[model samples]
Target: MTKTDQSSAIPLDTTARLPAVTYVLTFCIAVIGSNSLVLGPIAPEVARSLGTSVALVMSASAAFGLGTAASALLMARHVDRLGARRMLLGALLGLAAALALSALAPAVPALALTQLAAGVASGIALPAIYAGAAAVAPPGRESRTIGVVLTGWTLSMVAGVSLSALVADLVHWRAVYAVVALLAFGAFATLKTSRYRDAPAAGSAPWPLAALRIGGVKPLLVACAAFMSAFYGIYGYLGDHLHSALGEPVSANGIVALVYGIGFGAAALLDGVVDRLGARRVMPFAFLAVAAVYLGFALAGGSFAFVLVITFLWGLSNHFGLNVLIMRLAAIDPARRGTIMGLNSAVTYLAVFAGTTGFGPLYASQGFEMAALAALVLMLVAAAAGSWRLPASATPRN
Candidate 1:
């Protein structure tokens, strides 16, 4: 193992349980993920409540993504200086305040501003959460540990999105944000009282540019960009296609999302395979699997049943791809993990924007099949980038 990997690995006795702080970090990620995803399901209700168009309400989500990308690129390096625990605490507090403000927003502009603030907080918190996850991982189990934390995304999809929609229907759209605010507050309190302490790394780079210069960083990031862009591009318009093209109801669309989340969470059982095989060895195949899933989407877009099955496979492949990519990046340079992960988050959100916007014209001109094909092309690019063989010095010791 590389010295960087060894440094982050926690020595544990046999049969010792994971640190409590690990679960706390997972909850923190779940809250952050929920905030990012909640806007989608509740957009119509929010628009109705604010007396605005649905598109305008959705623009608030775009604002959040923009803010998150900007903050991650600019401020994430601070985690290396301030320490992950401290940065996370402050960011969570900021997120809670932003969510509360979002709950009280009476206008679309106000809601957008609040979401932007929340995005800023999330940008900082996500990298810290990732770095903290790595820092707390037991030796030889890094992939599985990170995978456990990533299931927070699944939770956000299944429980967070579903519950927010239900709450908005049963109560009010504002209640969704209010409840998320309370959850953020709870996460903050738990983390604050926990024993997790991720001390700042010594001799870390001061700028993201230096992290880019690190061996193996550029290609991995290239793969990350392609991977995330493909996903958001296809996913952004999937529900619309199902409703318009296939005559599926809104509830049916929700079922697809739920099934996808179940598949994502279930794939955590296979994280140990990545640990045993090494991420560098497994990532190429994982990307290819995602590409195949996209191709399946193109072929099966007309059949709701087939689409549901393929969506499950999509979630499973995506989980493995994400897990391996993060494992490789976190193991690349311990000192620069915060910056590296920040870059990852920036690329991801930027891709979210790119995919959503880029695929719109295609989806409009041709149809969902064409968009699916386009996503397949991007995933192929990701697979190729992931397959690049780095020099021995640049390769992560997975």
Candidate 2:
């Protein structure tokens, strides 16, 4: 274990509890998840509006995911140079611009470009926010604080997907983008005036260059990539499956989103429980459980209630891998925080791109069952690799 002098490292006065910081960071996570959910629910409608196939509309999400992943390496350099607050504000502003552009997009490519821009913003801002949380979090409560922060993602997914689906049903698909634009602008303005500290500068090469030199980081990065590939593969194209399998194109999106949100939120809340029970012991089983859920997803579309239960389990296990991995990384040398998190975001988003982009075509042509099976295979691979890669030190006690 590593220890740092809190007096020298942490930025704000160590007097009052960091109230708004947590709130603001959680809000940011919510914003990121909101973007994903918004696109998911309205995917088919957006496809029709753009005069394109659902596969093509889905590629916008792929573009966003790929852009976010690819941009993380570059954004780390900027975050190092400009500081977290500045970078965050800029990203938020950029996201608002992107959302506005997406809403008014005259063509699919233009919409994809906007989503790509949003992806860049999301890539940079999210890890920076997580870094902030680690810096300010009260002692002995890091896992719980992180879990609390992730709950925003759950809320956003639930609220964004369900509401956006309803809006798409009642109004138009474009309305979802318009609402996101306003929310991004609002979040940006709120965060602009807030006080937050940038991490102490480590004199190092850019994240990508530095990552090339570091060997220990590779295993963790690979594990994260594998984990996220499976995670996003299932969640990203779920709306499409809801339409194809259940034949509930309009309302199914909202219901599926609700199911996932409840599951994710409940699982996140259970992080404390996992902590008490031991993360290692709980996490392995969660992975296996989630793989089984994927199997269920393969078989689920026959019944609405069955889909709900399966989606819940999927959400629950998704966090187990992520939360545990983060806790492990936080225990690594603090100087490497930026690079570690940058790669984490990079690989995860790469998986997102792969899963969302790759599986959509597969799901469209081959059908939902095969796509679901593919997700299961990916998760099983992840579980096996993760079991091997997890640092013994990071393993939770049974």
Candidate 3:
């Protein structure tokens, strides 16, 4: 093992078991979710408010996603030297400013710029938070803690999108950004009072100059990309699908988002399920569930409630499997947690961007059923590939 790996190794000790680390994880994940939901349902309204086109308003999401992808891959190397707490604080400050700017943006390009800034901040925050979790958690509890932290992001997506949509409907869309800024401010305050400290700098590994060469890292990145591609393909256009196909209102779609969020939260709580059932087994099953959900969605015949339930199940399985993979990566290279996580984030966001941008025209031209069918096939293929690539040796046990 590398020196940094030895240093990052957690003992089953009391200090590592403190709750403050959990608080930090929760706060950070919430920020991710809120940032994710800032667009979509509100895009049209934002466009109208800014005197621009919906397409232009939606481009902000793409810009943000691009920032996320680029920052994760490029910034992974410097996280150790920067310190997790300092990195997180800097990210938060940048995000806060971006939110404020986006909320008050007078033009489409300016809004996009602010969104990109927020995305960059979030990209940095993600690796830091993951590294911190690995640094602080007790041995064997990495998966569970990672699950809890990631659940915060899922919850934010569910609540943030739905709530922001509702708030935007009642008031101005700009108020949504303002609210996010305020929530982030509150989270920053909470983190300030917590006793969580940065990982010790001694024996820390310098950032890898090349791409990840560790066991499981490459395949893990591929799975991350594929999984997120399927995820974003469906979710990025879920609102339009609901309205255009099922004739559901924006508010109703928000409610559906809440249901999906519940599923993610439920799955995170079941992190131990991965430990008990084994990562290899649980991951393939989760991917299969996503495929099944997509199939159900394709055949739902526009049944709003049925589709909502399908989405919920999809969220549950996707989160469960993804968290298991994250835990595996952390275990394989504990010293390079930030770099590994950053790579994962980069791949995932790249997939998301592709799904969002590439799938749109296809969906618009082919209709929801065809789009859903394509996503289903892609997910199933991803599941098969993941199962095949993952060796039997890596399977986890309760």
Candidate 4:
């Protein structure tokens, strides 16, 4: 279809208000994020249940990451051709089914395969969710809308993690996936029935390669990589550091996570500042703030109280960095949003793998202090990339 024709297909809301469906998108994101993180907390239980080693069970998470990265790179272009709503519905259905299968898997390999399927669905669903959010947002409210959706990560970190651990202890590990499956189904139903209009696909070019050539795409992606990698690398080892170095209990780590989630969720209130300042102007400072937070981590790694405080700041700064990165990418090219976001998600999953694996040896030998320094360096790199200039046309409207 022609660009003009594609634009015409999307029904405009005369009132210019954010749609109710945005909340459903947030819920969907929470469920998807939960699936990605659940394995970490429940790995031991899953390993015991399947008669496998903890490392083997954990490998399922890696399989899921690989599936997500591969599918995002290869399948995200379909969002433009299929329309966001249709793509999202299909993805949600697939996710629900995959999670259900995960819950029922009789062996470790079956669980890994099912989780991989879930990851593929997630790879598609996330970009569609982002594109749909941007599509339905009223002018001047794009960043705020995206920020609201991003709080879903906080939900995953707080409620999803805590509840999964509880269920795994009190009930069974499989129940965690079962609950997530139900949540996914619930989100799918809400979205399917909501009054939200689907944004028509705008890009006609073959997307995977075409999106990279777009002005301002590459730098933002680099920033995304560094940003995500830094966060995951430090996060992957935080619990171990607390237990081994500081002699803190597991509950202390949970407290840190809760405080961080509070900061992340609270930062959504300031997203309007980005909407006013423009993502391009806000991004570098946001990334710099994250670098500063990492420096704090390096300095305060020994004190539990200081760690708690720094973790909160870490979440707060990271939220702003995430908000700006996504807002900028979504604003860069409306026609190619699906592909751009797909690439963004691809880089994110790959970074998750890279961060954990790359930081493992350094963290093991040099300890948490050095890992924090490593993350600080990466955040500095992200800050520099965020400073790169974008085409005038690619800047988000203030």
Candidate 5:
């Protein structure tokens, strides 16, 4: 395993902190993150242009999630052997190509294929980015460093979707994607030249998925998957639901994206709270909160104000809860941190696929709230399951 003197790296919590590198990588993280919300803002436009139903149009989200999940399960381990910097550059290039192809897609099937490509790239990018963060972070502030960087996901929701919405209105939906593609390309170019370190590890290790079979690990994964299913399910269809309820002739996708993002961006500070409470103690309640907000969103109807509140709470709890779970899981076997991080990414995206896929027909037939009610049931189960086995490593550090 490679080792570096801590004194050589930037102090993570210093008054004059080293945010440039973190922020640059964070920006790259945000670029890939656009794929997660890209279809949401443009769902209505994509359906109309491609001549498909809303449910069918949104299937692209499922395809993307599935691709990401598959990559996480099938290919993420390569991040360790291949090196994070190389993997990141490769993934970003692939993502750019996928988005470019998505811009020119003539049919829903073509879109799905390209989205799958993008998802796979994203799946690959995540672990590399996280590993890169750990490599660069100072010793004492590992959790805090991760928490700050994760805000990129939330930031993507705010910036990527909101801007894409407005851009789609003025230019073309394809144009919005083209711009995102450019951002990805630029990030790739910058990252290629930077000095970010690779994740240090002993010579290649076996794939670590079997580690999940250990005592507290399996339950945490299940609880995490269940919790994620509920959160991602509501978010998948949030745009279409908003468009239908508002009765706006034009899709106010920008407005919808912006409002949801506002909640998330504002709530990005929840990382501090999670740090203090410890994930094991706080995650179950956060999952319950996710369930409640999603349930409220499903029944919100014309009450735009209620939707706003629900969106904010959804951002706060899910981000905080999920981060805690991953951190706790990584701590379970520090030696296998890289493998566990990859598996966690796989589970997260796969749960999103489950949520989007299973909930689509229900969302079509019964509306978003009813589907949310189903997700709520799953969240309760996750909460209960989580209560059964809190890992000793997960005690609050604060």
Candidate 6:
């Protein structure tokens, strides 16, 4: 085992169980997370409403990613001392305001700005949410707790994206944003009104670069970036692609996205899937599975049914793989969990930024088929990096 993996090994101890109220923190996560994928379900309508092309409208998507990258890079170190409750509340409030602003945006530029604000809020909130889950977890249950909380993101895909798309089809796209605004407000209220307690963090700050210097750390980071780039690159364009390729309605796109979410949530919550089979065993296959699915989607023609199946399978495999990756990173340094996780978040969204921006024009020219092919190349790299570099010990339960 590499030194970092050795360093990251967690012990089962008699730690306190997480309080029931802490689950509110998870809802807060779902609301904030909706901001990231909101554009995916409604991009075409957003483009038409703003008098822009889907490619240009994607700039708003890029802006959200950039905003996330900026905040994560600048402020990740201080998250522990800042307190999870404080950061999460602040970010949720900002997200509510930003979503409301998006509802009223006059043009693509205005919309992009609003999304930028929303992205920054998400970038700040997510790491804190993960850290908070760990802080309150009962030792050995930390992984399960973090996984449950991540169900927030999964729910955002299923409930938030699908429901918003349904709402958008019924009304205007702006109404979708309005509903998100209301929900964000409701999430904030739940957190604020709950019997919340501030989880304590270590007195010392996280040094991400220090962890990065470890033998396996750099490879894992690369693997993370590559994985997200491949996954999100296609995901960012899935709805628009479906619309243009098959003349499918937004509701169809929402259904497919919900299926994808179902796959992810199901895999993440599967009983003893990770523990029995182990993450090391699953990770490589997941990496290859996502790549193959993307390639299949690229070649599958405009059959929405085919696309839906591929999308669902990709989500199932990819979410399982990502959970393994995240567990490894989270275990890298317990004292600096917040900082490491924050860096992980930055890596993820920035890769989303790169993939979304990089593939927008590619999708415009050679189509989503070529775009998926491009993402496949990155996924292959992720597979290799993760397979070869992450030590066996990285999977603790194994």
Best TM-score goes to which candidate?
A: 1
List TM-scores for all candidates, in order. 0.96, 0.82, 0.87, 0.94, 0.82, 0.82
Candidate 4 global CA lDDT score:
0.86
| Candidate 5, pairs of clashing residues | 298-369
- Clashing pairs for model 6 are none
Task: For residues 223-272, write the lDDT of model 2, one tens digit per residue.
Answer: 67767777777676777666776777667767777777787788766666
- What would the per-residue lDDT of candidate 5 be over residues 1-398, giving only the tens digit for each residue? 22221222333343234445677678877887886777777777778887888778777878888898878776766776777778889999999999999899999899889999998998888877776665565544444556666778767877877777678778888887788888889889888777665654567744757756545667777887888787767766776776786665334545555666566556555555554445566767877877777677767745766766676677666666666666666555444555666787888887876877788888899887787788889888888876665445533121
Task: Give the poorly placed runs of model 6, Cα more than 4 Å off.
Answer: 1-22, 43-58, 165-174, 195-200, 206-211, 237-251, 276-281, 298-303, 360-373, 388-398
Cα lDDT tens digits for candidate 4, 259-341: 99999999998987876666777898999899988889899889998998898998898899998888778776677778888
Report lDDT per candidate.
0.88, 0.71, 0.74, 0.86, 0.71, 0.75
Q: Model 4 — TM-score against the truth?
A: 0.94
User: How many steric clashes between backbone atoms does each model show?
Assistant: 0, 0, 2, 0, 1, 0
lDDT of 3: 0.74
Best by lDDT: 1
lDDT of 1 by residue, 56-155 (tens): 9998999899999988888889888788899999999999999999999989999999999999999999989988888788766777888899999999
- The TM-score that candidate 1 achieves is 0.96
Question: What TM-score does candidate 3 get on C-alpha atoms?
Answer: 0.87
Tell how far residue 322 is off in model 5, in angstroms. Answer: 2.5
